[model samples]
Each structure stands twice: as structure tokens, then as C-alpha cells.
Target: MTFNPYLAGLKTNAAEPGKGSSGNIERPQAVGNIPWQTRPAELTAFEMTLADALQAMFRDGVETLPDIVARLNASTVQHPEGSWTEQNYQSLMNRLAAGASV
Candidate 1:
């Protein structure tokens, strides 16, 4: 599975309707722009090692799929502002599934 650096950096601020001191203010645009000055390259060796360890755990049936998902969700919650997303989840799952069949 391919990695998406863009999705890794995706962030959104909730739009709220309010007034400064008078009337209702306009809703802000839902822009998909990444706030980073520059996008970084591929994952580093440590990151790859971590990913590999997780993948191996999945591949070896060390944990059930649900357990893995739960752990991932917990991780996302613990690091809410970090670079984990649905795309990353799918990619990791796909890779693990493919590895399992091999």
C-alpha cells in the first residue's frame, strides 16, 4: 500500500458561528491546506521499525484484528494532533492483510 504524506498532515478547525459584539459572523471556509511550511519526506528508520513491528504483530496473529484497531484508536486519541488518519489505518490494514495471505 502507498503512503500519503498529505493525509498525514491534514488538519481541520471546526467552524463556529458567532458575533464579535453585534450580529452573527460568517462561517469560515473549510480549506484543506496543510499549514506546514514544507512537507517532509518518507518515514524515517525508527518510524519504519515501529510500523514493521506493528505489521509483524498483525501478521503473526499476536493480536486479533479488533484488538489492533482498538490499540490504534487509543493511540490516535492519546495523540490527537499527530499524523494518524483513516487513510493510514486503511494502508496499514491492507498491508497486514496482504502479508497474512503470503
Candidate 2:
């Protein structure tokens, strides 16, 4: 947790112009990458993970198991476990049937 831009060669008062140590402009951590930012690489929703989205889709569609799995693999949603094979899809349903949430 030890961090301070001064230790990484930045001036002790360094920050955005006119917003140094006393002006409240948030400083990026000096230990890692400079000019830090928060952004999603693939732009997925934060409201639910892939598993929850899959379960909801399956419940709403009355398709066959294979059809459901195929749609899941083809949809815009990304799988957390690489790809969703038939075995993995079955196990996901099994867990849901046993009252699991994402």
C-alpha cells in the first residue's frame, strides 16, 4: 500500500495543471501505469454476469437443450469460463435447479 508519486520521480506537488497536492485533482498511483483510467475492455453489463444472463435466457426460451446452448454460444453475451460446452451448460442448469444464483 506504500505509494506516492514523489517516490516514482514525480514532484511531490505533481498533478493536473493547477491541481496539485492541494487542489484535489486525483492523482494516479505512482507504482503502476501512469495516467490511470477505468474502462471495460469488452463493454459487458455490470448488472449481471454471463452465467446469470444465460440462465435467464434459458428460462425465457422453451427451446431444446442443444438449441439453448447453441444460442448461448452464439449470442452477444460472453462466457466467463472460456466457452460454454454442452457439459458446462448442463452443469450450469443443474446448479440453477439446485437454487443457485450467479
Candidate 3:
């Protein structure tokens, strides 16, 4: 499949891929063949953006916490406190997961 910006689901299209043939970019409904899951409404905007940035970092093979924090600091996505530290990363993850029953 061709690279599509809509496939990321960050942008909505009039008609998504496999739903029609408007000749616009084809946004696949799944990632790695798994159906896309809806994000929880409880997550704040900062959390959502942070999650996206972390997802991109993981896809690029940045696994270590320090490295991830460093990359996040270097990127435009600022942490809620202005910068990401290993400590804050852990704290935020814990906080985000605290209310998550799943």
C-alpha cells in the first residue's frame, strides 16, 4: 500500500481507504493487520500527543527511557512540565495506568 498520512488516523478524510474510491489517499483501517482501537476519552490532549510521540520513537527503535526522554526534549512535543525526565516518564506512566482497569 502507498504511504498515506490519513493511515495514522491523526487526520480524517471524507472517505477512508477501503470504504470508497474517491482517489484520495487510502487510509488503512488497521496497523500490522490488527484493527485500530479507539483511544480512551479520559486521556488528556498532552497524554495523547505524548503517546503519539512515544509511539513514533518506539517505531524508530528508541527503547531506553533516557534516550526516549532526550528525544522528547529535542522534539517539539514538550512534556507537561516542560521537559521529560526518566523520573517523570515513570511517574506519568504510572498515573496514566492508575485509572486504567485494562
lDDT of 1 at 76: 25
Q: Best candidate per lDDT, number?
A: 3
| Stretches > 4 Å off in candidate 1 | 1-40, 64-102
- Name the candidate, 1 or 2, with the larger TM-score value: 2
The best-first sequence of candidates by TM-score reads: 3, 2, 1
The sequence of per-residue lDDT tens digits that candidate 1 reaches over residues 1-102 is 234343444532233333122354433362333354242444545455557667766786758556665565555232223554556656655754453210
lDDT of 3 by residue, 1-102 (tens): 223333354555453444334566434563233233333234556766888999999999999988998999999888767677899878878876654411
Instruction: Give the candidate order by descending lDDT.
Output: 3, 2, 1
State model 3's lDDT. Answer: 0.66
lDDT of 1: 0.47
- Candidates' C-alpha lDDT: 0.47, 0.54, 0.66
For this target, which candidate reaches the highest TM-score against the unseen true structure? 3
Q: Please identify model 2 stretches exceeding 4 Å from their true place.
A: 1-62
Cα deviation of 40, candidate 1, in Å: 5.9
Clashing pairs in model 3, backbone N/Cα/C closer than 3 A: none
Instruction: Flag the better candidate by TM-score, 2 or 3.
Output: 3
TM-score of each: 0.26, 0.38, 0.55
